[model samples]
Target: MTPYENVTFKERLHEEAAKLKEMSFRDKFWYIWEYYKFPIIGVVIAVFLVGSIGSAMYNNRFDTALSCAVLNSRYDSEALTVDQYFDEGFRAFIGLDENTKIDVDYSMSPSFDESAMNEYSYAELAKLTAMISSKGLDVMIGRPDVIDHYGEMDGFLNLEEALPADLYEQVKDYLYPVTNAETGQESFCGIRIGDTSFGEKTGLILEDPVLTIMSNSPHTDTAIQLIRYIFEQ
Candidate 1:
C-alpha cells in the first residue's frame, strides 16, 4: 500500500524484466535450460534414432565381407549350384578353429555385364558398379568372353600376381591368354579351370570355367584358397 502500490502493471513488468537481465550469466543459462529441457532431450533422442537407422541401412546395403559372386549370365540358376562338399572344405580351411565355423556367401548371377554394360539395364549396371566399388565381389567364374570383357577394364586381378607362389606354380600353365578390351593387347589374365591342368602331373582336373579375382576383392586369401581347393579336388 505504499510505493509498491503506486507501481502500475507496466512498471511491474519492466521491473521483473530488468531483474532477469541483471541475473548472472550462469543463472540465465540454467533458467533457459530448465525451461526447454524436455524439448532439447526430445531433439537429441530423435537425432540419435535417425543416425542409428541410417547406419544400419548403410551397412546392410554394402556389407559383403564373406561373399563370393560368380557372374555368368549364361546360367540363370538363382541358387548356388556349386557342390556343398567343397563349401565344407573351404569353410574348414578358413575358419578360426574347430568350434568357430564360418559361413561363405557363394552366389552366382548371369546379370553382370562388361564395363561397357552392353547387356545390363541401367538399374542392373548401377547395382553392379556399386558391388564392385564396395569390394563385395570376391571371385568371378565365367566363360572366356566374359573374363576377357572384365579383364579389359582392369577389373580382374592378375592371377600371376595374386596367387601364392605354390598355387601360382600349379595354375600358371593353365592361365590362358585374353585380349584386353581396353588395350587390344593379349595378357594371361585368366586361369582356364575348364579342360586343362598343370601338365597332369599334379593330378588336377580342369572344369569348364575360367576363374579370376576382382581387382578390388577384400578376400583375396580366401579366393586363392577356394581356387586351390577346387583344383586339388
Candidate 2:
C-alpha cells in the first residue's frame, strides 16, 4: 500500500536522482556508499583480478631460452656482476631475439650441512626443488657439496649422455661422478669448473665449484651450449 510499492523502476530511479541532486556533495557520497558500497568494491576487485591475469598471460608469452641458478654463493657482489655478464653474453652467444628470455639467478644460497641449515636455507631448497620439478631450471652452478646433494637425488643429467662426444672427451678428466641414492648407479653428473679458468675470468670465487644440468631441462641443447661457452671463455 506504500507509494513506492506501485512506482516503476524508472520512476524510482528519477526520484532517487532528484533526491541526490538536492543533497550536498558529502551527503550524496554517503548516500551512494550506503546503498552501493558492495557493488563498487566488487567492481574494483574484478578489475584488479582481470588486470593481474592479463599481465601474467602477456609475460608468459615469451619463451625462456635458458635458466641457470647459482647456489651457495659467498660473495654477492661477484655473483651479481657475473649474473649480469651471463645474461647479456649468453643472449648474444646464442643469437636469440629479444622476445626470448634468459635468466641467471644468483639469489639462492642454500646450505646443505645440517649445522648450517636454517629457515632461509630450507626456503631456498624448497624454491629450487619447485623450479626443478616445473622444468624451469636448466643448469645449476654450485660448490661440490651442493652439487653432490642434488646429484644424490638423481637431479642431474649424465654429462656423458648430455654432452657431445668430443666435448665430453675434452672435459672427461674433470667430470664429477655421483652415485644415485635410489638406484645406486654412478654417473658423471657434474663438471668441475673451479679448477678451470672460470674463477679467473668471471671473478666469482668458489672453493670447488661444479656445473650440472637438470635431468628434466626443457632446453638441453642450450644447456650444453652454455657449458661449452663457460669453458671456452
Candidate 3:
C-alpha cells in the first residue's frame, strides 16, 4: 500500500543499510566498532603497514626519477630540488646530522698541500673519498684516481727526464701525498677542473679541478638498482 511497496526488495535492503550506518554514527559507533574489535584492529594495522611501505616505495621511485632528471640536465633547478628531496629522504635512513655537509672538491693531485695554495680554494676530494669509503659506501671504485690515497704511491714519472732526478723524485709526489693504507697506491689520471674559461670573451678563466663522483652516495643497493634501471632504459 505504501510507496515502499512500489520499490523493489533490493532497494529496500539498501535503504535500510544506509539508515543503519547513519544511526551507528550517531548512537552506536563505539558499540559497533567494539563489536568487531578484531576485524577493526586488523584493518587499522593493515592500513599502517601499507602506508609505511607505500611511503618507502614512493621515495625510491622519486629517487630514480630525480636521478634521471639530473643526468640530462645538471644545472636544472628542478634537478637540485629533486636531489635535495632525495638526500633528505635518504638522510632519514642514514644516521647523520641535519647540517652534515657533503663538501666536494677536485684537485690536480689528491696530495695537493693546502698550506701551499688557497686551502679554501679547493674541496678535499681525497677527504671525501676517505669518508665515503670509511662509511662503507658499499661501492668500490676500481681506479685509484677514483678515490683518495689509501696508501703511499710509488711509480715512475715521465717528467723525471725533464727535471733533475733528485728534485723530480722529491717533488713528483705532493708534499702531503695521498697514499694508500694496505697497498701504496697513487692517482694516475686527473683532469684539471679549476682555472679554465669556456667562453672566448671571458677575460679570466677559472675552472676548478674536475672530480668525478661516479656513483650516488655509495649505497650498493641503490647503485645496483640504478644499474638495472639503466639497462632497462
Candidate 4:
C-alpha cells in the first residue's frame, strides 16, 4: 500500500498537532492565564495575609484571656490554684483571695477545745491578730470586730443554698464562703483582705479599712498589675 494509505508517523503527528491547536487543554489554559493572572494573584495574597493575621491574633487572644483571669484574681489578693486558670473569672470581683474558701473545722459535741491544733495551726490566730492590729482595734478577737459593716456592690451577694434560712440573708454579702469548721457557722462575710470591709450597714464598706491593711494593699492597682504579669505568655 502507498505510504499515504498506511498513515505514516509524520503524517499522523501533523494531524494531531492541527487538532490540538483547535481543541487542547494547553490552548484553553493560555486563555485563562492571559485573562485572570492579576485577579488570581490578588486573591492568593489576600488569603495568605488573612490566614497569617488570624493565627497571630488567635495566639494573642489566648495570652490575653489567661492574663486577664490572673490579673483579676490578684486584684482581690486571693490565692490561686492550678485549675483556676480554666475557671470562671472571679479575681477582681471581691477580696484579693478567692471567696470560695473554708476555715478548718474541729467539732466537739461536748465543747472540746483543740489545744493540739492550736500549736500547729496558729495561722488563723495570726490572721485575726494582724486584722485587729491593722484596724487599730483592741487587738483582740470579738473585741474589735466588724460593728457597722456592709458592701456597696449591687451583685456581690453569695447566698449559697446549703446555709440555714436566717443565716442565708446574714451572710449573702460574705461572697460564697464555707462554714467555719469549729463553729459550724458561715464566715465568708465582707471583703476583709485584712482591710477591705463589707457588710449590710455602711453602704461604703471598704474605704477606710483597706488603707491600713494594704500598706500598699494587694487590693490596689499595683496588685492588679502583678496579676497581669503572672498570667501573660
Candidate 5:
C-alpha cells in the first residue's frame, strides 16, 4: 500500500534518470556512490587483481634454459658482464630462441668461516638451499671451499656419470674430489677452473674457482653444453 508498491522497474528507472539529469555533477556522483559504491569498488579491485596477475604471468612466461649460481665470488663488478656474456654467447652457441632465458646469479656470498658468518651469509645460504631443493639451479661456480661445502651435502652430480666419456676424460686431471657426508663415498664433484683462462676471459678474479653441476638439474644437456661452451671459449 506504500507509494513504492505501485512503481514498476521502468518507472523507477525513469524517476532516477530524471533526478540525475537535474542534479549537479557532484550530486550525481554522490547519489551513484550511495547506490552502487560496493559494486564499483568490487569491480575496481577485481580489475586491479586481474591486471596484477596478468603482468606477473607475462613477466614469467619465458622458460629458463639454464640457471647458474656464482657463490662467494670476489668480483662484484663482473656480475652484469658475466650474465650478459654467458646469456648471449650460450644462446648463440645453442641456437636458443629469444623466449628462453639464461639466469646467472652472482649475489650469494656465503662465508665458510663461522666467525665471519653474518645474517646476510645465512640468508644467502638459505637462498642457495632453496634453489637447489627446488631444482631451479643447474650449475654452481665458486671457490674450492664453497664447492666442497655443498658437495658434502651430496648436492653435485658425479662428473663421471654426468658428463660424456670424452668430456670427462678431457677434464679428468682437473677433477675436485668431494666425500659425500651421508655415504662417506668419494667422487669427482667439481672441476677446477681457476687455473684456466676463465678469469682473464670473464674479468672475474677467482681464487681456486671450481664448477659443479647440480645432481637434480632439469637441464643436464644444457648444463653439459654450457661446460663445453666454457672450455671452447
Candidate 6:
C-alpha cells in the first residue's frame, strides 16, 4: 500500500486555505508583515526624505529677513565678495552679536534684455513690492537710475521721519534728497555708495553702490543704526 494513498496535492492546498481563513486578524497581519516589512519601511523613508528636501528648498528661496538689499547698477567685472567688505567697521555698524549678524542682500539691476527699459519686469516688481510692504526688506543699494525708478513711486522711506535727530545729523551728508510724488514733499532718499575709499581698513568697495531704505519698515531703527555705523566708520 502507498503511504500517500489518501492524501493529494489538492487536499493539502484546501487544508492550508482553511487554516489561513481561521487565523485571527493579528495573526494575518503578522503573516503579511513577515513578507513585506522591508518594502513598506523603504517607502515610508522615501516619503519622509522627499518632504524634508521640499520644505528646505521653499524656505531657502522665500524666507527673507529685515535685511540690507543691494541692487547693483553697473556690472563690474572684478568685485570682492560681499563678505570681504563686512569687516570690523561694518560689523560694529550693524550691531553684530553672537546670535545676530548683518545680512546684506545683493542683486543686479534688471538687464535691458530682461525688461526692455532696464527695469523690473511686471512679475519682478510685484514680488519686490510684496517683500517691501511686508517689511521683509529694509535697506537698498543701487545706482541713480535704480534709485529714480523706486523714488518716483515714493517707495523709499524718509530719513527725516525715520531717523532720530542725532542719527540723521550724523549721516545726512551722504543722503541724496528726493521729492515724494504723492505727498509732494522733499526728503532724503538714499546715500551714495561710491567707489570712494571707505578708508584703508574696509578695502573692498562696491563700484557705484547706492544705499536706500524702505518706508514702513518695522526694523527702521535697526536700519538707521547700521547707517550711523557706516557713516561714522
Best by TM-score: 5
Name the runs in model 5 displaced over 4 angstroms.
Answer: 1-60, 76-80
lDDT order, best first, reads 5, 2, 6, 1, 3, 4
List CA RMSD, all candidates: 17.7, 11.8, 21.3, 26.5, 13.4, 17.2
Tens digits of per-residue lDDT, candidate 6, 6-115, equal 87989866866786799998987887568667776566555544553564355547533347666543333355345555534565556565344455545534332444
Q: What are the TM-scores, per candidate, against the unseen true structure?
A: 0.54, 0.70, 0.24, 0.19, 0.71, 0.57
**What does candidate 2's lDDT look like per residue over 23-139, in tens digits?**
999999999989987777666555545554574356468888888887766664544467545667767887878778787776788887789765455556666776788787899
lDDT of 4: 0.31
Regions of model 4 farther than 4 Å from truth: 1-22, 64-233
In candidate 4, what are the lDDT values of residues 177-199, reduced to their tens digit? 33334445553322222222221
- Residue range 116-184, candidate 3, lDDT tens digits: 633322333333343344342322222233334322332112222333455335434422224434465
Residue 53's lDDT in candidate 1: 54
The sequence of per-residue lDDT tens digits that candidate 5 reaches over residues 53-134 is: 5643564677888988877666646443675567677789999998888888776777878898654555566566767887
Better of 5 and 6 by TM-score: 5
State residue 197's C-alpha deviation in candidate 3, in Å.
Answer: 27
Model 4 Cα RMSD, Å?
A: 26.5
Where's the lowest-lDDT run of ten residues in candidate 3?
Answer: 65-74
Local distance difference test scores for all models: 0.60, 0.80, 0.35, 0.31, 0.80, 0.61
TM-score of 2: 0.70
Candidate 6 residue pairs in backbone clash: none
